[model samples]
Target: MTVIKNAELTAGNSFTQNQALGLLTELVPVSLNNINGREIQTTSAKKLHAYLGVGRDFSNWIKGRIEEYGFIYEQDYINFDSPNLANQSTESVQIKQWKTKRGGDRRSKDYCISLGMAKELAMVERNEQGRAVRRYFIQCEERLQHIAPQDVRKLRDQLKARITAANDFKPMCAALELARAEQGKLTQAHHYTSESNMIARLVLGGLTAKRWATGNGISGDPRNSMSADQLKHLSYLEQSNITLIELGWDYHQRKTELTRLSQRHLAKQLEVAND
Candidate 1:
């Protein structure tokens, strides 16, 4: 039999876990663990035990619960004691060695129970903390269920298509600007170059497209490296520039208007995110 040392199991600190925690209730932190190429929502058994204020030793309590409920290994929970941990990333399962009462280092037996197992365990406890945590788990499940992974992927693909379509209009607008310059006898090769630089500067914080690509070590357009939000904002600015060009606004006038528009759009975005 393996001796279960009294040590706290560290919660996952990965970005996915942190982001989920921020969105869900933080009463009991959860993690997304990769098992056999699939991600599972799990929580630390030790943390759950501590949160429940159980009177029995953690090892005995967990073992008794598993045996009593007939919880299957690797299906309901995962034990970190196995040598298989060598194949996993540290971020996936955070395990740490601790000093024992005898001043010796030992790795504790840590278990990560699935959300289903966790809810069942909490329900069996029949206490206020258990009830509260069970409800929290239910809420987390409902929220996650609303945004399935496939749905998110589909939405992202749609956004990419929209951005690409928006990009195609920019060149057409540039040709319109060239024609307008010719009619006004202000035709200059540098006009098109300056207009492109202005859009890059407005969207990328003063970095020209070439400068941004070089700075990020990108071989092509820097838009490919931009976040979804940045790309959407870039699309909006491009359309705005196209309109200003049609309205016969000079380069300096359009630059001033675009700067103000970008600032206002960013402020609105921040406000909406906060709300």
Candidate 2:
């Protein structure tokens, strides 16, 4: 067993090109797992098991695969079973517990396995779903290899621009709220939150900024923790919302328009990412 230094996992900076392409997202969502002080692309073994239609219980299936393949612990995978391990590390590590089919709450151990290990496991399963999953992983790897360093830097620059724009929007929004209050048009004190939550819901698929922050173990603004693609989507919606606000559109109308715009923007971004 390899002793993992800094055995803590945090969110990665950006989504991979494969994710942007929506190739492996539905089948098995990949994330960056911190291991040995480096971030490696990994997927949840439990999710993979479900996708591959594995008949065995999750615990037995995962353990059996690890033992059969001689996978090194803390190298190919890491278990989020020990709460003490999280306390020892400075980084935020969220240990998720789920309810069973019978509605019993259970905190089961989850394994984040490296992409290489996942592919190997998929290949060994020798079933149709397994073969399809393995092929998808291969395609993901191929797309990832094509993402140049300059492409990454471009995305980073876009994220920075969007963040700055969002910060600038806050003061402007406050001023608008202040004017509304002066004219007796403001009905609530949380106008800033309302506007921000509107954009967040549209971009984040109904998850408000506050809920996203709480779920991710993030404090303060959740925008700081968002991925580049997410920021881009958010910034666009903010700008659109500002325009609708100035036009005297009602909340429901703005929301409807923003929802449509978000869908178009996401599709366009996906096309760009694929290119």
Candidate 3:
């Protein structure tokens, strides 16, 4: 009889990306709130709670899997389900990763393995070319910038709704990078990269990989782990080698930096393996 090693795994298994997504989704109904100065108020927070419900349903399912099988570190604010790879004589594996940073001049997937495993994926992609995302925010922010607190709250709600709609839209970006180098000298080579690729690469540089996710769980603003839109971008940023935290996002509506890496994860792959 065939056997599955993890068949016995249950809710108590540990925390994982899938479990975490589920937990967060379940919390959406109770999570919405607003950023007030530095404090989170009940009224403003309600909108986000709603987003956690229907919008990020996909992400929520992923989180649920993590929360179920992975171990949750509330204090560390991180959860890990995969076995630690700190010590092991590893063999080659066709691991897929995102291009966290541009590899100086190398081609062929630029960089991979920057973002974590697939469960971290989110359906919300960047804004398409023709649509205007900031257009709505730009006008709204200006209109409410100097209004009274109560009045600002009203406008914020309107902006929030627009942001939600924008999240569902597929935004286009200018990709400008060699899709991949030619087999030989480019005496004759079709351009593989597009404007969308270039922009995708740049934006990937700002994402938050799994290793950096919990530690950087949307800083500054406790009002959000990361906004729904930002989370969506980062989710799509998965294969791009960026994480949500890496992108210039407003955790507390403030830009935050991710932890530095001592070396590229792909370095090992490029290294001369002792055959």
Regions of model 3 farther than 4 Å from truth: 1-39, 43-205, 209-212, 218-275
TM-score of each: 0.41, 0.42, 0.18
Superpose all Cα atoms of candidate 3 onto the true structure and report the RMSD in Å to 1 decimal: 23.7
- Ten consecutive residues with minimal summed lDDT in candidate 3? 109-118
Best by lDDT: 2
Q: Which structure among the candidates has the greatest TM-score?
A: 2
Pairs with steric clashes in candidate 1: none
lDDT of 1 by residue, 31-141 (tens): 678432235678878777767777797789999999999986755777876222221222333336333444444455768888889999989987655765677687666
Q: Model 1 scores what on Cα lDDT?
A: 0.67
- Give each prediction's root-mean-square deviation over alpha carbons: 16.9, 17.1, 23.7
**Per-residue lDDT value at 129 in model 3:** 10
lDDT per model, in order? 0.67, 0.69, 0.29
lDDT at position 193, candidate 3: 25
Which has the better TM-score: candidate 1, or candidate 2? 2
What's the residue-level lDDT of 94 in candidate 3? 25
